[model samples]
Target: MTAEPALRLVDAAHPAASAEGVAPAREQERPETAGAQTLRRGLAVLRLLTRVGPGGLRMGEIGHRLGLNKTTAIRLTRTLVDEGFVLHDRAAGRYRLGPEAFAVGLAAEPSYELQRQAAGMLRALAAESGDTVFFTVLHGHESICLSRDEGDFPIRNQLIKPGDRWPLGVGAGSCAILAALPDDVVADVLARNAALRAEKFPRCTDASVLSLVRDTRERGYCLQPGMVFEDSWAIGVVVYDANEAPVASISIAALRSRLGPARSAMLGNRLMQASKELTAQLKA
Candidate 1:
């Protein structure tokens, strides 16, 4: 006989062998450990720098916030400087975010352009709907108001200035964009925001907020009645880029009484149309 097959020989040696036995062995014994603590320290430094605005930060301050020794913080800062993510000022003895960081930022600059192009559309929509219109973008698990157009109505929702950040799932504009995010990104954002949600948005439950997100994806818009403010309703549509990823959202806030079923439906349609037009214009 030629010989018994390899599977047969192996099975003969181990009678109870299964298909799993025939599979290739894992390349590595176990997953490699990551330098997560170091990563966290680095991120903490970046956040502290951001909080200090563009003025840069002294080494002592960065060390104090991170609970790191000055030498340790200096080592980390040196790594960041080498990678082009941060820069150190020799005379001032301070560190600031550098050009490499800005390069990564440029990739996300489309959202800012989108906001600029949507300004006029938002204004027209606000004028037509008699409600405040807001253009918002998702930034590090929060939604930031990038621009706004106030309606003619004297009594309206409180104005939100550009750069003001809101929890991702708190308002319609944010929820709409979060709902349209890639599934994995949504999960990551939710995981990262669990504590924040508990602190700033005690009224919102994970299940209810996720349900709203699912419904937003299905309905092509998000409508929240009294979620952000009492006696007011916020409605929003996701603003997509050429690649179809959600880059921003446009929201309309109106009095709950005026946003009856019929009026709400009308406003939703207008908001969606305006969002589409702006997306097209921005891409152009």
Candidate 2:
């Protein structure tokens, strides 16, 4: 205990325990937990709102769509509003997409090169078929128009601009996409859409909607006569990715009078070929 002859010091020593007066050893940071994962859920909510279009969803609708409770939906919306990702309209008691979201969307557009590359193919298909062609991708439970080309026909279906949302089981484009989804996902989308349709278009029932989905899958495409617009017919083919997953849909819209058996067959062939070509381009 008495300093034992002053223990001899050795020049050979370990590295300093501190670097620049800061401890080198510190606790490792942990990955995100459940609460942190909620951030992603919030972002998903914002995306769903945008997909729903300018007339954003109400609290209850958002909750129903996301499988969250009303309280959770309100809380999430409040957070989004605070962050300027969504704007609540007090007068209309509805929500609209905020400016900040638009800024982000504008920035992200070019990153999705598929839309740009598919535009040329869409135009060529339109010119060849003389029928209005639409390129749409799935967003949440809706199909969003990403690009379109007008036909040379004297009378054609009006163009659906980018960002326009349509219910997943309503028209040929939506049905084609939905049919390609997993069975459970298709059922869930149809069930949710059935409730929405009852509120919006009461004439369309769940059975009819399911029938359309089945027919689309059976035929490898969707053909809807006057489902979306009066006197308009649409034929849709699914555009697949390298994994054979349906990533988008290519639809031809024409006047009902011009969609006879022969015309329908020709349009179907053209749409199928264009969709295959576009899918190949996406793969490349």
Candidate 3:
């Protein structure tokens, strides 16, 4: 065969062969593959660490909460530590989030902007209402307090603060997000966290959960009057993200004596206004 003639023939037949530099599109992801499963479990570990706060969790506790066996949890945590996604304390035998995980969270440029917006709004609301205003974000079935601003209230709520977390229906901001969820999602969350509520928060009942959802939808905001504790109350509104999802909430919590019907209405209006302003900024 003549080499030059064969080359010409092949190029003619496959004219785009020289354009092989162009990359093909990535394949669509499937649900149940091993890689997907591993990613899910790894993310679960990170989320667990995030919820456990600075104290972190022991390997045994991590396994118990995640339902992983000792050997499997060891392998999973080792991989996370190797990748800098987790930090293992040799002396304490506790596992916590590492710097790399914070790097990943900080890279969420939009959440930074969201926090800025929230900080200003929280400060304003706390000042205007003379109550403690909290910034909370939804994490799975719970809400984590990202930040809070305290007003000059003579008595402040000792309930929620930065780094504290509660189940969805437990706190004002948490219930705000929970109530803003679509009906089915609200129901699912209630069902999913029923056991947790019964164990940790014995006061919250299914009837009350339904009532909060109903009242929030009807009233167009969230109110948890003495739900978490007697002589304590809170009101909130959900703040939507750019995706128009209820990713977080802002609320004002106060002593019941300070947040009666008249004061509640006044603070509720302020809280809703702040929520709207923050939502607009975030979705922008």
User: Against the true structure, whose TM-score is highest?
Assistant: 3
The sequence of per-residue lDDT tens digits that candidate 3 reaches over residues 6-75 is 1111122344442211011111235698877778778778877876578889999988988898997888
For each candidate in turn, give its C-alpha RMSD to the true structure in angstroms: 19.6, 23.9, 20.9
Could you tell me the lDDT of residue 186 within candidate 2? 82
Local lDDT at 57 for model 1 = 84
Ranking by TM-score: 3, 2, 1
What global local distance difference test value does model 3 have? Answer: 0.74
lDDT of each: 0.72, 0.72, 0.74
TM-score of each: 0.61, 0.63, 0.65
Candidate 2 stretches greater than 4 Å from native: 1-103
What's model 1's TM-score? 0.61
Can you give the lDDT of residue 172 in candidate 2? 81
* CA displacement after TM-score superposition, residue 191 of candidate 3 (Å): 0.7
- What lDDT tens digits, residue by residue, belong to model 1 across residues 1-284? 12211311112234344221111111112333457667866866765565455789888988986689988899888899899889999899899998987897789787477776777788888888877788888676877776767676756565355555776777789889889877888787777776656654554557767888988887788888765455667888888886777878899877778788788777888888887887677567
Candidate that beats the other on TM-score, 1 or 2, i.e. the better one: 2
Work out how many backbone clashes candidate 3 has. Answer: 0
